[model samples]
Target: MDFFAYLTRFYLPFAFFVMGESMQGISIKPGILVLVGNKQLEIIDSVSASKIRARDLTTGEVLLISPGEIEFELKKAAPMSNPNSGQTERTSLIESANEADIELASDRYDVLLPIAGKRPISKKDMIQCTEALKLSASQVYRLLDKLDTNIGPLSLLPQRRGRVKGVKLIEASAEDTIQEIIDQHYDGPGITYQEIFEKVKEQCLAKSIPVPSEATVSNRLRERNPRALMAKKYGSKAASQEFEVRGGKVLPEEPLELIQIDHAEVDCIIVDSEHRQPLIRPWVTLAIDVYTRVILGLYLSLSHPSTMSVALCISHAILPKERWLKLIGMPDGEYPFYGVPKRVHVDNAKEFKSKNLEDSCRKYDIKLTWRPKGVPHNGAHIERYVGTLMTRVHMLPGTTMSSTKNRRHYKSEQHAAMSFSELREWLIREVEIYHKTTHSELKCSPLHKWESHFKSKNGRFSYPSIVDDQKRLLIDFMPFKKRTIGRDGVKLHTIDYYSPTLKRFNIGSRCIARYDPEAINKIWVLPEGEQNYIEIGYADLRLPNATLSEFKRAGAKLRADSKRRVPAAEVFKLIRKNDALVNSAVACTKEMRRMRERKKTRLTDSGHPLNEKNAQQVKMSTSPSPDYSVKPRPYDIEE
Candidate 1:
């Protein structure tokens, strides 16, 4: 009998079947941590055929959930196997292999992945792969067999030909002596390979072991990472500069095959619309298509870089720009670039690594990749583009000019004239101009390059898939929360939300909810086992819309005032009051400055009360009001 039948016969209380069929629970094992929406939960135990008990890591609350609630596996548990079995063997093999062997194995694995499991691999494909890997057909088949046994790069590493790995020809003492000499002197400045070889030989002899041949010593010295050796001899910066030039470039064949996203604080200061006074330097997130070098989408905001900025930038990139341009009071057809990219490359910023970004990309089958940590050159294209764009910004009215020395005697704040919305419009117009201007590398405008790629060849034009649901796309990219529905509504961060459609779900059923960071008054809920999302607005409609930051600030103010149980309405009221105070404060400051100016003028006036005594001491004729009635005097009576 199978495992299920054996369990059923032995344990009568265990329910292993549902509807006369074996019902296996989720594949996730107990004790694994999973991300369900924004909460991290550790699985405790399987409770039923379809449910598992878990504990919330943040709140330390225990609850039961189904497989559908899991959004991502934070840590993957290893397979059940013997400690000394295949896992251990593979691990040891990988440890024994060097970096070059592993790189070669990885390349071979990638080449063979296309036809990994195909039976009787076609001669044409086999020949192509063999040619690419520079391997014989029989050797390729052997590697394929090894792959079937162990599906990893370790299985493909080139096997040692003569002596087995870790069974060295030289004695352990001699090997240690060579390594010591190499560490002490081999990487020094002006050291030669012959000198390193001679030193290794001398050390090996001194250790009283049979001296290893010069060839072996030279091979050991060569085995060190060239970059690491260079860094040890010179400096890390010089080594980096030497290796920064890449042999290959990012050359995507299609428009949306590759895209890059990055954030930068704008050089120019922006003012508030009402006050027309300098507010702050705003941040801008830009998304560019690598293939055509076109600016696909951009988001400008006064807030700092965060997951919301990334989500909004992605949303803007995916959705068509016509509606956005119209909303910004620009020509709708100015920017036509829009589509889901096949792969998105970003820096190793926490915002780029957010689970929200991963979920959204996974939902659309888009690949998200990050550059290696501390490797800024991987993002060279975007960085250079940002620099070029900032150069144009330096021409603006309130530009800070990239550095303090460059901005000497330039009062950015006092000269600030453009409002936030006005700056946004200016940026859009500048983007249009950039798209039409010729690029130094491309020798053609970005827009022209984009159009040329889409031009028809053989009656077929290249076009990317357009997003079907714009609102849903935006909601999918926003940060999510998992909460159980209740009789009242969903309470998120002390705010209660309700909608009539929420009545369909069970009282305590957990659901996924996403909120726009710009507006905390509303959220979209994907009810349990439901595909469509229902809109949930504030339970108290009297509360006005406020940003997440504003709400947080209001909550902090209430807590500082020693108020407990701060209601949503009360928090929003404080937000409104704070906003009013900010606006009034600006106006009050302007008025106070004007009043001070008038006071200074009055103090300096010649006819001031304090100066009247000094004026009386002077000649009275000089101080007397020149009588307009004596205007009859002419040049003839000048005497």
Candidate 2:
């Protein structure tokens, strides 16, 4: 018999059924624990059709038991006074049959004849059994007929209540039309069941077929495959999340096996490097290893988060930290971690979902996973790390704190003490401190955890080696754009870039240019179908320190100042001359006003506040120190 059929027949009294064994009105399958007699027993094997091989749960003794005996024991041990007594018993049965693929069986075994003895069932007994099971007299007669016959109660157990056959009320054609309407309109915004019903009515009337009622239509729509319906109406993304099986929490066994990258605007204000004027808050992108919770790399920039920032952060993560540490003036061992991660988990931000990042990851054989939107727990590790880092940033001068309410009456710009370079160094030191400090979740320093994991004898720990060509790898991760080589030069953002290597290429031929937006001094150009890129400098080399943001800002300032369009060269010149003054005038004027106020309120002698005239008189009265000339100090000095 089929599994379900067998379940409906022999194992109907019990709540659960396993394939290949039966015991005490319950199917005791292999690997299931059950209460047999006074002791719990695990069914090890099905020895025969009527007997099961079971091992004692406590004593480890093995024995055989009939299916009837197991059922009797289960009944005797069942609680008698619980409100949900039946449900509790069923739940217990199900809990015991925890083996995979077990099926729930019918609970109508009370109607079956007892299999223990061959005594014929009496008419009174048959009537009593039928009444107890709520079965008809004809069914009772059928059971009686099966006594001593091959066709027994087991043979009749598979029957169920329902029409064996029926004539269609709603024709298949009408049904198909209703389904089509549902498919077309269900996903549309603000769609409703009434609208769907109206559409189905129209289709049915036009086709001259009987229209199903609104209730029937609603039922059919509800019965449609949930996953398929969701995919059609909402989107595949929603459907996958709703129906897809999610993986459990994963802890990587090896470092660099999985990493998470995210960006956060540092909580404090910082001054510009050249102008020393307070600028907007800088952004910091961090890449952290999942296994040891160690920070792999970090990139700090004035620009907002973008695909370029993600690329730069990941590139830094893959490269050696020695040069970077020395360049940033950090100690050698401050950031010891480096290697290409096998996978990177990121949020669904446009920058992280960009084609450039996807392509770069694919090229490096790295798996890039975007966490589902609104599901913060999936990326909780990095999110928590960002929060922890921001807590430290809040303690610095000029911090905006957590919110506007928290920052009430505080001037982040006025209180700002660190320049951009200084902030960078401070962040590095903070990151070092974080590495040395014990993590709340890990209960040990990240550096210590990383070192111990590697040094352990367990084969679970593994180390990912660094890349060979670090420079080439960094270049590969930089932002790229396509341009054609021309006789004059390749123009990028109104600036001409040229290289001696371009002389070999034909004019009008296309090439790819890779650049760092923060430093527009030079770009790397790759010829079509070539693996290597040649370095190209801007045609106007004097503006070597010009960045993309500076150029844009310069253009904006010129437009605002002149109130008219001007040549690129004029704008560039204006930028070079007045870049520092462009945004510093208001701040400088405020500083100057404050200084004048201090001068005006100066205190003089006798603890009295001095006005302008009194201060001048006091300044004039103060005598300068005298300098006495030495008159040929020694007698023999004129040799």
Candidate 3:
């Protein structure tokens, strides 16, 4: 076997040092004392490929032996009888050797030595030493001449060949002026050497000083380190792009140890849930496990991603998937991968760095790490996943593709075939399929890998359960604001929220209010030092389906329509009026369509076809629930 192979197969202790020339001729070197069987031997040298020369300690005789024939332990080096004396002797020997070499070289060159309180060497003695050293007479004479000029021993050594000093055509003052001009103009957009040169020439003319040629200034700038120049002129961003430093790769040891979360805009257009008309692409928030490259959880919504989206995605990742799967109409299956990550890597987006997010992570014992700004590769795994998912989305009917050039001549809105609900279901199925398919790097399906991780003995998968109630978790993630309770109610975004319980609190007292952005009909109010929250409903409770975004949109529309700053109360009133009108129109349109369909159906001579009216009456009696189209008031909002 080769020496490396041998070392790999055997465990070598720290004391042993192995040295072998090729694999064939392996043997211990001279001066190493070792034991072979019952014999103690001092290695002399290698005689052949299989034979080693060693002196038998007992017999005091040399012998040749095969290395494989013996098992041995290397004898430890003997300690000095007197450590201080040994150290002193070693120091003295080193000094003596240095002096000897120096004296020999000087004598060979017939050079005069300068020793303190010692007579210099005579010429005859130097000549004799030079002749004894066997150096050529001419060489010795030339060395002596160099020494006579006070040249040091180190000076005699050869040096690398290169220009030690560059030729300077401009004076120091002119060079400084040129450098100043370059520094001043370097950060300017599309700045050129000619511009800086012209500036320098103009300055020289104004000062009545000699100006250097343009070539000289260009050479000076070019000679400067490009990276340093770029940094000095343009900034670190430019320098970083021109000169990149590869960072160490992060490889987590176990699943769920580290997770990366990011937000991406999905590239396909889907119809809105309420309007049932094609809307802009939705933003998707995704969380992925760094170790196994498994997608933990994702959130899809028409609204732009926010801290709430991040929190919701994290909550989904930590919770079990059984409930979510059933809600999405998927077959009975387990999404067993879930746990509170030890560390979460995210970008420096405002939502990622929010105080609430930081506090929540601290509460859960998860360390939050923000990748350095402009370093997208730090979170490359999640970025790549987003890109891969977007590629699949591009294959859908209403894809915007990636860029405008790719989307040229294609109208995504007109080609859209899926509603928001249908798109969500499709995404869910795609995610499931992605979990089952083999990962390019993992060599196994993410689901299979996750299952194996749980089953493995060394996995030590810990199930992280929510510490607080689900409602509390949701409340913690909700957007919070400090407000002073007024005589009327607590107003947020111009919408008044009130509760009978709030009336007990003193007016003008500061309190905390938390509300879901997606559902602004009700908010939870907790007075200062209070342990529980009182639910507060909107003053105009009829607009229970209004969202925070919708309220803001209404306000903006009102302002634009009036061509002036509209009051919050007026905006709220207009929003309700517009919502009522739209709902009434939608209801009337649906009724008209139903009546047209009924008229088209051929009825017998009777008012209805064969007892169909009776059957319809019976069905209506069995299901007497109110129309789900009407917004339901939150009764629990009141005290």
lDDT winner among the candidates?
Answer: 1
lDDT of 3 by residue, 265-350 (tens): 88988754444456567778999998878889777766678877887788777766665665455546546667778899999998
lDDT of 2 at 126: 65
lDDT of candidate 1? 0.74
Sorting all predicted structures by TM-score, with the top scorer first, yields 1, 3, 2
| Candidate numbers, best lDDT first, in rank order | 1, 2, 3
Q: How far is candidate 1 from the true structure (C-alpha RMSD, Å)?
A: 27.2
Which candidate leads in TM-score?
1
Q: After best superposition, candidate 2 residue 567: deviation in angstroms?
A: 5.8
**Per-model root-mean-square deviation over C-alphas:** 27.2, 18.5, 19.7
lDDT of 2 by residue, 314-394 (tens): 888887777656544455646778888899999999888777788889889899998877676688788888999999998
Identify the superior model by lDDT, candidate 1 or candidate 3.
1
Q: Model 1, range 1-639, lDDT digits (tens) per residue?
A: 343342232222211111111123235888776666766677999989899899887577998998888766643222211223545666576567776777777678668866764555789999999899998999998887665233255568788878775466777887887788778886657888788778877776666678878788787777878888788777787689677566676588878888999999999987655546676787899999987889887987767788878887888888778766654456654888889889999998889998879878999989999998867777777888899889999999999999999999999989988866678788888889989999888899999999888878775667667888877787788888999898888988788999998887889988998886666767888888898989888887767666676688778888889768777777888876755665466355643333322232222223222223434555455564333324456686686
Candidate 1, after superposition: displacement of residue 164 in Å? 54
Q: What is the lDDT of residue 190 in candidate 3?
A: 69
Task: Report the C-alpha displacement of residue 411, candidate 3, in angstroms.
Answer: 3.3
Give candidate 3 regions above 4 Å deviation. 1-245, 273-276, 331-334, 456-462, 486-489, 501-509, 556-569, 580-639
Clashes of each: 0, 5, 0
- lDDT preference between candidates 2 and 3, better one: 2
